[model samples]
Target: MKTLISGGTVVSLDPSIGDLARGDVLVDNGLITEVAAHIDAPDAEVIDACDRIVMPGFVDNHRHAWQTAFRGIGSDWTFPQWAAAMHGTVKAHYTPEDVYIGTLLGRLEALHSGVTTMLDWYHVAQTHEHEDAAIDALTDAPGRSVFCLGAGWGGGDSVDDDIRRVRARLSGGGRIDLALGMRGPGATGIDTAAREVKLADELGLRISLHIEAPGVITALHEHGLLRDTLTGVHANGIGEDELRLLADAGGSLSISPDVELKMGFGAPMTGVALAAGLRPTLSIDDVPSVGGDMFSTMRTAFAAQRGIDGGLRSRDLLDFATVDAAASMGLRDRTGSLTPGKDADIVLLRTDDVTIFPVTDPAASIVSHGHPGLVDTVLAAGRVVKRDGALVGVDLPALRTRLLASRDRIAEAAGVPLDGTWRPQP
Candidate 1:
């Protein structure tokens, strides 16, 4: 099968290919075959890309997709307060059905927003059935995903075995990949974290974890567990030494600027990461407490980093969500850039949209003024996931009903009110 996206401004993100003001992207058998000024494939389905910006789809490095149903539940709460409300109270009430609904809904939102690849930090897999439900949701979603199976809230004793079980069940490769999510030394202490890291290493699985302090990275280094496959999430409080250590170890960092700013994770480490010779990826973190799309994340990261230190470009912000993000997830060779041999994970934004009209520079316009509503079409692995400004084959009304019902049931069961407002105790 062949598809030709014709006559658009192509932002390949590949230094070799560069950006094409007017070009066509040719996809054959789920891979981009060519990107040039003209493509003359006679039997291909032609997608008109005129007056649009065609670029590689955004890759979100970290997100708690299971928290989708609880959106806006902790808008006014701090990190500790939100953690208490969510992990301490709400997570206990989620059924396997809730996990499925949340995961599917979140991935669908990613597709609608031109994010074809996402790293889902799913921590709601309390039971074996819950794990299966989460995996099923990822499988059903029409995009590439890395599901980082977590050690549930408060941690789990059998987390190693749980990871092994998940690996054995979903062993093969496809759009969905498996990773281990850990709480690191802060929550689990060095000894337990070391054991978990050893187990993941033996299983040959990539590891993702939260790093609120420099001590966590020190612990990983002490245990000799810091490597390229280790992705440190929220490296907000880490100092220069820690950042250099992480960069030297070839480990990636995921910075969620909006969540970090709102929840007091300190300023995002974008400038610090860059100065430390690291290209950190951007993420949405928890949608319940922050915005859920990459556009907001990119904009927030760019502005926040600039406020910390100037000399950042709109292209740099876009890279944090695309090429740099794919590198963080170990997917650079697969789907980051619109290179010829890479997977056809692409997003087409309408330059004619009200918020993004008068496209001066394609990359700048996308990073500075892009929104989910301006995403006109999205293709994942050469398959049309979103087209003509709508997600294909999705019944949004039905999904919304199911999600609302799940949210209500969870709140009622947990004995918590569903009010969106949060008040701090004096």
Candidate 2:
């Protein structure tokens, strides 16, 4: 199928093609076939991009999609409090059905907000059934994703078998890719981290780690686990040497500024990552405590960085969520920019919206004033997942019912109220 997006302000994010004040894009067979000021495709579906900002869809490099049902549950909690509530209490009550619903809803929300590709750091695999449920949700969703499978709080007894099963089942081929989410040295012991790294390497899967401490990077490097496929998430307190090691090893970082600030994870590592020659990607992390929109993530990152480094550009933050993000997830060759031969994961933001009206600088308008509601159309892999500000093939009312039921059941099982005020027992 061929689709032509015409007459939009194109922010291609590809330096070679550059941004076009008024341009067109052509997608053929799920790959971008052409990106130019004008394209002549006589037999193609025409999408009018007038008064819109056409760009590659945001790529969220890190997110916990399995916690969608727990949104706003930890809004006022610190990191430790959140960990206790989620890992200690709530996750213990989540059934496979709950995992399925939450994963599906989270991925759907990402797509609705112009995030076409996501790296779901799904640490909710309590059982093999739970892992399967998470994969099923991503497979059912329209957007592209990397399912970074990991054992949640109480699910590590048979994690190796479960991981192997998931790899065998879903690694064949599809939009949903497989990755290993490892609890690195800081969270787990060095021996456990080494074993997980070895398992991931043996399985030929990329590894995602939550870098919470300073020496975790050094530990991984010493174990020969700090490679190109290792993505460090929320690298808060790591120093220059650690950053240098990551840069030298070609490892990437995923920073969730909103969650970091809200949960007191310290100042964001955006400036430090950039200084160390790492094009860090932005992420929504867990939407349970904050919103799931990439626009808010980008805006928050931009503001935070600007406060630290006055010379920060809005376009830089935009890149953190777009092209740079795709690269960090090892998806640059596939769907970062609107480059010919790349997958057509694209978004169209309504320039005529009240908040974005009279768009002067396209990048500035998007990074500063844009919101999820301004997303007009979203196409993932040449398929229209969202058009005219509505998601395709999604029954919101049905999803809401399932989500509410799952939340209620999980809350009840956890012995907590449904109003999200649950705390871990002393």
Q: Give TM-scores for every candidate, taking all chains together and pairing residue i with residue i.
A: 0.97, 0.97
Leading candidate by TM-score: 1
Q: Taking the tens digit of each residue's C-alpha lDDT, what string does model 1 give over 91-165?
A: 889889999999899989888999999988988767889888888988998989998988875453658788888
Model 1 is weakest, by summed lDDT over 10 consecutive residues, at 417-426
Instruction: Name the Cα RMSD for model 1.
Output: 1.4
Prediction 2 global C-alpha lDDT: 0.88
Model 1 residue 27 CA deviation in Å = 0.3
Q: List runs of model 1 lying over 4 Å from the truth.
A: 154-156, 424-426
CA lDDT scores, all candidates in order: 0.87, 0.88
